[model samples]
Target: MRKSPAAKAWTRCAVSGIAAAVALSASLSGCGLPAADPGNPGRPVAAAAAAGSQGAAGNPAAVTAGSRVLNPANGRLEAVVPEVSRTVLLIGDSQSEPVDGWPRLGLAAAGYNVYFCGRGGTGFVSSNGATGNYIDALLRGDWLLPSGTPALIVIQGGGNDAAGAASDRQITANAERLIAELRERYPSTPMAMIGTLARGEAHGGGRRTEVDALLGSVAASHALPFVSVGDWLTRYGLAKDLADTVHMNPAGRQKLGVLLEGRLRDLGLDRKPTADQQPLRASGTRDDGPGQD
Candidate 1:
């Protein structure tokens, strides 16, 4: 029988970029968020302020969960101050999907309202037969946050591109384009990039290593923080956490989440909640670990 498209995509990522794929999967899955509540979708950090509550002079009467407040003095949204509950925009591939990834969980744990946009089999330089590459998706406005401007924007990928053998020039050009577009849109917001993942003894080390180096160079040129988790599985003793060669098991996912949370904190991207703010939690369960597949 022929493999399904989803299956084929998974196979391609695994076969071409198994080390990268596994590392990405571990980083994301390990940091999975608590299941979302049906009543309160998306904006998990804090409850919405009461409607008609006064904000700065010219701002809207109702303060939505993640909406920008109008600055009465300046009469412009641009002057709006960062709220106690910050917002984060995360863009990546299957590994960092919003469903239950570490980026989502780590940010949420840090009292952030996370907007995640990720597609399986997609990357900075290659789409792995998906609809569009990262640049195309960003240009088309595929993964924008709904309301307020994100305080932090994170871009994660390159595994698929490395696996697909995307040229360094292609990767660098697309990354630059993506950064330029983001800067134009959110000039003041801080940005960061998480590079491709890898295992220490992987056979495809050459390409994955090259992709990691290219990503580092791009981040440096753009003056953005770059976190490389390529050898996380081996370095962190997470080899036994693999559900497969390219995906993490439940235990591995938990470990990855802890590791990522620390990284985010170390970079100063993840902040603790203020006294009045509360961390987001699911209605039923407190434990946010990924369920059995």
Candidate 2:
């Protein structure tokens, strides 16, 4: 008897110790959120092509305080400074949980103060009995930070939904509801969505393909930057970087951080470190709290 692809993926996830990752997510502590870098107070850091552009090297240029640049990724023209005046919010599932997950690390590396709200095994449409689903959490104010409004918001999920065989209509409806709620709350805040993960060559043909497509369509309708990182592991030659079928290891996490930095830069959403900004800790631990559900 042959194992189904879904079973194979699930087996890989279990073998990779995803359970441990969830435990780690729960034990993590929030860092002492730092202020902007104090060295260049009040001055806007100028964006240099080398520092702001995403090329084949996959390396993100160091952003200075108060720089303005055109992001080649999403063709959005915007300033990178003033980010110091706000925070960034990330909402996602297990893949984006764990203090050291790529999305959180990447946003922090790019000079933004980040607040992450991740629930392992949860998705835009899937509910974690404790905190409910992403939309429910937001609606109930369970994920709000104890500070100012976020300058940007990023939503990452779909893997769990796809794995569970959630219907296309279900995913889309839930996604639209999530986006609508977010827009109603923060009408002007910039938002982006990331799709499911998969092997490089198998991306467009993988199990989560439909979920990814629906996510892209939703993003398109909202005119938001929608990043499909399914092939990132294979595209960047980080196959060995995966800790499981869907999660990234430390090395993989670092690589993903760089990739996300480049993507944010491309979307003109990269943050410029303020003079008061503090440096990222070597341990890469700056989460606000444990996974809620």
RMSD of each: 12.2, 14.3
The models' CA-based lDDT, in order, is 0.57, 0.60
- Model 1 C-alpha RMSD vs. true structure (Å) is 12.2
Question: Would you estimate the TM-scores of all the predictions?
Answer: 0.65, 0.64
User: What TM-score, to 2 decimals, does candidate 2 have?
Assistant: 0.64
Q: Which stretches of candidate 2 lie over 4 Å from their true place?
A: 1-84, 145-147, 200-205, 273-293
Q: Model 1, residue 118: displacement in angstroms?
A: 1.9
Among these predicted structures, which one has the highest lDDT? 2
Provide the lDDT at 219 for model 2: 92
Could you tell me how far off, in angstroms, the CA of residue 284 lies in candidate 1 after the best superposition? 16
User: Between which residue pairs do clashes occur in model 1?
Assistant: 28-102, 30-253, 30-257, 31-101, 31-102, 31-257, 32-100, 58-72, 198-230
Cα lDDT over the full model 1: 0.57
Q: What is the lDDT of residue 184 in candidate 1?
A: 70
TM-score top scorer: 1
